[model samples]
Target chain A: MSIIKAVHLRKRFIVKKKEPGLKGALKGIFAPKKIIINALDDVSFSMKKGEIIGLIGPNGAGKSTTIKILTGILQPLSGEVEVMGLNPQKKRAEVVSRIGVVFGQRSQLYWDIRLGESFELFRRIYRIPDEEYNANLELMDSLLGIRRLIDIPVRQLSLGQRMRGEIVSAVLHSPDILFLDEPTIGLDIQAKRNIRKFIREINQKKKTTIILTTHDLGDVQELCPRLVVINKGKIIEDGALDAIVHRLAPERILQIDTDKVKKDFTYPHCKMIKCEENKMWISFNRENVSASKLIAALSAEVRINDLQVKEPDIEDAIEQIYGEG
Target chain B: MRCAVQSWFEYPLEMLCWIIFIPLYSFGGLLLLKVISTQFSEIGGWTFHGLAFFYGLGIVTHGLHVIFFFAVWHTNYMVLNGEFDRILLYPMNPFFMFIIQSFNIAGYIDITPGIIIFTYACLKLNLDWNAVAILKLIAVLIGGTLIRTGIFMIAGAIGFFRDTRNAVTNFMVDFLAYNTTAFPLNIYPYGIQVILTFLIPVGFINTYPAQDFMGMDNTFSIPINLSLCTLLVGIAFFLLAYGFFRFGLKHYKSTGS
Candidate 1:
């Protein structure tokens, strides 16, 4: 059974039509106009109990809107949404207790208080049992090293540290599902790796269903097994990571670095894409041309010093999907 | 609340200014009172000490409103800045969270002075201190604070519908209610007194209850008992304000990512 479901969700916003210049501003105050913006149009998707689905989209693609509706922070103009067998709209408080949400662009921590104090506040708000709260704290400490930073006030922490603190506060209640919106944004390599590891550990240990929305392809590549690509308030494609990648960009690239000048060589199964003084690039469909067989054919013609095989990455596949739309 | 207090105290200069200004402002009110009483024993059939009691109620509740409902005043800013989105995601009641988050201790500076002045007024006036009087005082304080909170909430909720900030919030809370509540309501014309008594109900803060306690004539001929009417008006306005807030949340379109 799906843990989270959104079907035919539609939402529209009435934005004021602001005119330009001082005269226009005065005119707006006297007689303003408004236009309707379709924030989400026929957006639909479903996720299983323990799957981590990366929801990727271009800016203004309704990615955040979908998360907002599913999390009950927003009410769709028309749709059906269920999180953990409860309609989020009607049962917001109950459903929210069963889920955790983190927005990387916004921190939920209390700015004036220490990290530990924020957690304690959440503890009382959620009314989490003592054992469960402490255990979750220990788990978060192991995964994100939350203990060392507990004494520090939120405003004093760096962006990376604050993001980690945000994640800890979100999950301290052991929510069955977690929604992370760009959780690894604006982080260094080490911080990103640590966050990714923490997410993976949580999912594995507790079977937590995670729906991550991110523009950073690295986050998608590292954490999400399933991909739900959205564009212009529509779901373009949804499936396993490799399946989407293969369907969008079927060909892989093979580069050969030889000792001396190399003549452009082509195999019947593979197409030669580029040739330099000592390197040659070939593109071939993985389904038809086995890497071993292609390498054997290339070696017969030239002395290869080094070879590298490159599979199509999530970024290229997502870009191609977005481009098509 | 503790955290908010600590953050304010972080700047010594600001704290010093607050400490000094609180008393200075109270003394200004006393000076006005002294000037008026020196010329005449009473302005509107009320002694200086009696008028001070009314002034104390308004000032103390204003201080409480600032301490407890500060978030309501800033709700517009939060909505415009998208900080309110944080409040909506929490599992608990968002209104409760907003109230708790707004608890500020700096208001204690203003409240402390009001309490000191109120005690002095009661002693100087030799007012009755029976259980009934104590009960009436508690009821008025709660009702008055609720009225202030309702007005502030209504003001802040306007931001949820429009992108612009309105000046009515400042006019109502700062000038309209604050200035009117400190003086005897009877000093104004009958029409104005009626509006304050029945329509906006700012009179419930100190005017009607103070009149009832001091055995004076109330401005409005309320159908129900004065004490009950005061409490009910406070509650009714508060609930209406909360309902308006819920309505506003339905249209709360959070700003940029």
Candidate 2:
């Protein structure tokens, strides 16, 4: 059964148009002009229980608006939203208990207290019993390697370490659905990899439906199978990540490292993106010239030291969808 | 609940700072009282010891709000920072978690001193701390604090709908302080007094309790009775605020900044 469903969901905000200066500030108090903001428009989607879907979008692309509506934190102006067969707005307290959410760039874990303190607060708040609490703590420690960082105050942990703690904190209640928004915003490569492993492991073992919204395409590549793309208050695309990637760009970039120091290297079929000496990156349409053909063309001019072919990654695909610079 | 309080007092330096800060405030308040007490024998014939009870009552509750609800002051900041979203995902009441999470133990500094002053005033007057008097003190102190916090919760809930909590919150504090600490409601004309007792209930903070201590007539406590009625009305207001907050949550657009 689909655990989350939304149809034609819409929302708008009236923000006061503020003007600068003393006179403007005074005038604003009396006569304020409001700008109509259509944050969400005619959106529709659904998620089955235990499915991990990645929601990707650019800045001001209505990613948060959708998440808020689904989680019952927000009410749609005109639309329908149902989570677990109940209207979220009407049953926020009931729906909220079943869903876990994490907003990145903000630490929910207490800043002064140790990570364990925040964990205990959750345990008592959720009315979690002793046995389940200890078992979950042990499980999280094993899964996220959080045993070392337990006693350390949140102010001390690195961004990556804090995020690992955030994920475990979200799932401590054993919620059926986990919503993580930009969970790896500012993390090192190793930290990102560690989080990716957890996201996968949690999904596989618990069948916990996950909705991940992230700027990091690498996260989507490694973890999410389904993709939901939003742009300018509308759903631009939603499907398999492969479909979006292939649909956007279907060409491979070939870089050929030549042994000879050749300055001028140009070809009609394949344009040299960079031709400084022997190392040159060649770009060709996949339909026009295959990787083998490009290799043959390169071997004719200079001895090929090393050859690497790279397909358009999810980053390029997403950028193309958004037309972002 | 005890665990929450334990976590709150985890900062020792903070506790010490509050302890010192309260005495500083008390000195200032005492100076004000000493100077003002000379000019004004009473607000409606109430004495220095009588006014001290009112002053101590306000500070004690203020202490409670400061220690327990320092974070409540930042309801807008928390929402803007996307901190409330953290509490929402939990399998518990977000409001309850936030109240507990934002607690500071330093309130006892001012509160303890205020109680001591109140005790001194009672002893100076040679008033009874007998069973009935003790019960009245507890009722006035605890109930008064709860009412103070409940009003703040209502105000804090307002921030969930609005993006910024500007002078509106300050306005509440200023307006309430003026009405409660400055004078008694009976001194004012009938219409103004009714507005205070019925509409806003600021009079409950001091005037009615002072009357109870002086053994004044029951009219002083009309405001207190109305405030007590908040047991039903306050929840309704809170639910309205909660509904409004949940509605506002849909439009919550977290800035990348």
Docking class of 2: acceptable
Score residue A293 of candidate 1 by CA lDDT. 94
Query: Model 2, range A1-325, lDDT digits (tens) per residue?
Result: 7899999999886778888999888888899878998888899999999899999888778888788778876678999999989887777778877778888867777776788888887787777788977887788888889889989988799898899888888888888889898988988999989888888988888888999999998899988889999988899899999988888877678887777845566656777677766677877777777788668866888899998998888888987888942
Off by over 4 Å in 2: A19-30, A253-310, B1-11, B27-31, B34-43, B61-71, B124-139, B166-168, B187-192, B217-257
The positional error of residue B12 in candidate 1, measured at the CA in angstroms, is: 4.3
* Clash pairs for candidate 1: none
Q: Which candidate leads the pack in DockQ?
A: 1
Error of 2 at B98 (Å): 3.3
| TM-score, one value per model | 0.92, 0.83
All models, DockQ values? Answer: 0.56, 0.35
**Model 2 residue A64 lDDT score:** 81
